[model samples]
Target: MQSAQQASVPQSDADRLRARAVWLYYAEGCTQSEIAGQLGINRVMVVRLLADARRRNEVRITIAAPLGDLAGMERALETRYGIGRVILAPFADPAGDPTKVIAAAAGNFISSGMKSGMTVGVGWGRTLYNALPFITGATLQDFRVVSLLGGIAAARRFNPAEFAWQFAELFQGEGFLIPAPAVVDSPETKHALLERCGLAAIFEMAGQLDMALVSCGGISQITTSYRTGHITESDRRSLVETGAVGDVLYNFIDAQGRPVEHEVNARAISVQLDQLRRTPERVLISGGREKHVALRAAILTLSPTVLISDEQSAKALLAEG
Candidate 1:
């Protein structure tokens, strides 16, 4: 319910009546017939008022089911991470990989949560790529999608540009991408690409995104980051030795969520940490027992307002905390 104090001026009698009817119907569990009588309005008007409230995002309805069977853990993680919302997908095994389930959950959330006329930044991985089938595309207006990272060259499975382009296609929005390699030979080349070329402008656009969708990668296994051969096993070992837990947007970070000193981080072409944080609404998506530590670090580093994972991963996160 919106408080009268929240408004700059007093609400008109009609507006107040609408609020009262909404309160009676949704919050008070009153039937539309009952609400109509109390508000001295017809049942049809009450229905319209309730519809208006929901359309404005003022009244959200979430079934206490879904990953919600573990609602206690979801709430706890939200408090522990200072996150606004936590979403988890059910997994039969705590030790099993929860990528597909989590991806499906993330897909459902993205399909609904993303509204028209918003600029969104996207990060790519197997999880996000897998979410494609589950995601229901929509025709939207004034929507823009920005690829937060560079593309992997000759990558058969997942590439940043491919994901960004497909995601934009899903919403029929304009897509902005960094037309460069994900990792370069040297920091000097990275500087030249950002300054000399036009990629810096893309990063600048990303810095002020309305929302950012990202996921983390654990170092326990040679995942996509290593499988691509851009990040070698030796480099992974070196990163873990430097107290790195995992990477977000290829910015390898430690347990404290601080980027560790590494040549890989320096030469990687992607959105900067400062730019990522500048985005108000950030969503971090990843899950699995192996990623618990990395997920913890990602929560600290990204400070995402929303987190999506699996119940087992959620439990592991709470236990670790």
Candidate 2:
């Protein structure tokens, strides 16, 4: 009995170590090198332990491959649309859900790219705002966050100025605001605002962004900014009649993702899509199943280099094509 007990001690210790290793590896996303250094074991040993844990069912890593389980949806859509990257947020009821997956991915991308002296232009939307929490505590260099579009419109609640300030504060960088209406009553007013010395300076800063972030407005006029009083209700009807699906940076795009021939959109004091594309990297985050069609329109029309969205949006996009 004593000899048998003695033999079981080493196995028991190994089992416990393996269990710990599995949790740290899969749950924590620790790299193999990190695991080895932390455990004071060879990297190869760490891999072996993880493999053993999996084999024994001590570590059950049930990767919920929804896009795949949903019928290879993500892969098909990525290929069809030529999207550089596509992420599907995990959620049971995606239509009624907030896009946590896209937000996390966008935050990860931003956090990884943050360094000193970089300028990042931000757009206003629920998705872009959601990404802010994930970007916290990153040691980025003295960067500046500028709003690509003016947030100070009729709605005082979802003010883009405050949003930009919060993001700049979070990143420990300077926040630059355009300090004008997102859309004016007329194109002449927009042009005049653009030529203003005060606004010109901000536009110059916005034009020179190293990186940019934006979101897509959905096709539904009901939930559109125009309908929500961000733009006049007349503007909303005009945009729909003009074939506009939604707007990006308040610039209306038609069903084919082409910019509509609207004077207001043409003169809007916001970063142009072409200018945004010229930036080294442009990240576009959009969410909601209701907005999936709009997201697809933006992807096809704007040609952003990167996209972040929830799984339902991703799956919906695949369905669109």
Candidate 3:
């Protein structure tokens, strides 16, 4: 009888080559050329072996981000707010600006949650604009993006229309924009536009959104609304007099999340706060000291299903409760 090693068939040669290639390439971090030389095989053959290994389920890759601190905070926020999901991004410099950090993490969360057939509603702000670069590009079918709010008068990087269009472009999807001013001259004009001037269709689309990505603007002087001149000095004083802490989609809200009585809220051309709450998945992405009050107000009002925020913001939010 032949020995066990001698009894093995010639097919084992290919298996051995594939295993060695995977080990050298992955474990030892060797270049394909180096692997080929070590195995005394052509580079093309080495590449094929590695491909075969992957196809055969012999190679597996995993990325484990150190998220212990984040996970704990996420759990705490979820438990406190009854939120469906919470993602806390780590920031090394607690005192540094949290826009980039929060945006990158929010982008990753949005991209991962996206599906082939889904309608996403987008809101405009610097945080949402900063998230554009971190989104992974893909082409999906039946993917639609709708701008939840109307456009600003001037051309700007973070306009509602621009953000919606760019987000749709990332997935090669369709974008439906509310082709009207963010704040009309009066409530009657806003009503006329929505009921008769083509904006009704956008509101109908908003009703069918699978998810919504939104941010809050604080009442502080440095807020996007203030900086962009959308909220004037008179408007600020009026809003403050009514106990407004911040706004979501230009609908100013108090600390308890009740919409403040303001003229701007009536003339605003955006989805109603009540409608936003009904969206299947509402994600609130914001951070920084300026935003903490706004974020809290948004949470009480929107009851967001998901929240993507920085470590400092998360801590402040939890402490508030």
Candidate 4:
């Protein structure tokens, strides 16, 4: 008879390859690229093998190091920012993209703290969307998800409405999406939609959220907002000129975390910054050196009860103060 590990995996070459990949990832701490190089395969194949292993219940996440190892850094961030709590993911290399690790840490946080009968207001971004796969889903009664911002015409995977809907589906709960553009052509048009298009009800729901999960975006380049064609290059230049560092829920804000005086801010449709602050549990999940200024602004603006980020970003945040 075959061993338990062998029995779980098939006898095919592919299965054996996948098993090896799992060992490299979980046991040896080899990255996908390293595993691929060792196994004489492409990185994509290594990724697929690892993913398959995870699906086959062969992946067990054992915490080799405790989070307390970085307690000092975490505590310093919490004290300085006046955040209720701070969780940091280990990022050995400052040059590497820390989005995945930060998202994983945030996923663990949400999975552990989420309870039934809660209304959650959600913000959209690559980091937040990446957290979806890591969240532990359960069918809960009276659970609801509110998209804090309006949806875009483009059906991107990270669309605000898509994230809200998918998150709700995970819990088998109700999802409320604002059926309008995130940024309307004019403030008058924005008001008309909220008043006459029955979108006011969605914002009304957002007002009473038990928790708000949000992320910030920097104005350094063409990010999601610009990618969606809602913001032009001219707009970006103008925003930079106005001292805008980044945006929270599409609300362009300056370094001080105050909404910048811009036409974009006036026409954007989303929960007001002040109202978002009122949420009983406001969680901010974002990181990376590019967002250092924006993250600081978000903390100042939202006063988030919880902050999930990477080690390098946390250090930068502390050093800047």
lDDT of 2 by residue, 212-310 (tens): 888888656565433365566677778788888887888788877888987768657788777776777777788787776678778877776677776
Better of 1 and 3 by lDDT: 3
Candidate 4 residues lying further than 4 Å off, grouped into runs, are 1-68
TM-score of 1: 0.78
lDDT of 3 by residue, 1-321 (tens): 223432452667867867888899878989778998998877656645654554355664432445546888899999898899998888656577889778888878876888889999999898998786566556678899999998887756678887887787667688899999888888999999988899998899999989999999888664464235456778888998999988899999999999998898999999999999999999999988888898999999999999999999998989984
lDDT of 3: 0.83
Tell me the lDDT of candidate 1: 0.81
Residue pairs of candidate 1 with colliding backbone atoms? none
Candidate 4, pairs of clashing residues: none
- Measured with C-alpha atoms, the lDDT of residue 140 in candidate 2 is 51
Residue 94: error of model 4 in Å?
A: 1.2
Candidate 3, residue 271: Cα displacement in angstroms equals 0.4
- Alpha carbon deviation, residue 134, candidate 1 (Å): 1.4
For 256-321, candidate 4 gives per-residue lDDT tens digits of 999999999998998989999999999999999889999999999999999999999998999984
Q: Candidate 3 deviates by what RMSD?
A: 13.1
Name the better of 1 and 2 by TM-score.
1
Which candidate achieves the best TM-score against the true structure? 4
Q: Which segments of model 1 are wrong by more than 4 Å?
A: 1-68, 225-227
Residue pairs whose backbone atoms clash in candidate 3: none
**CA lDDT, every prediction?**
0.81, 0.69, 0.83, 0.84
The pairs that clash in candidate 2 are 89-311, 115-141, 116-141
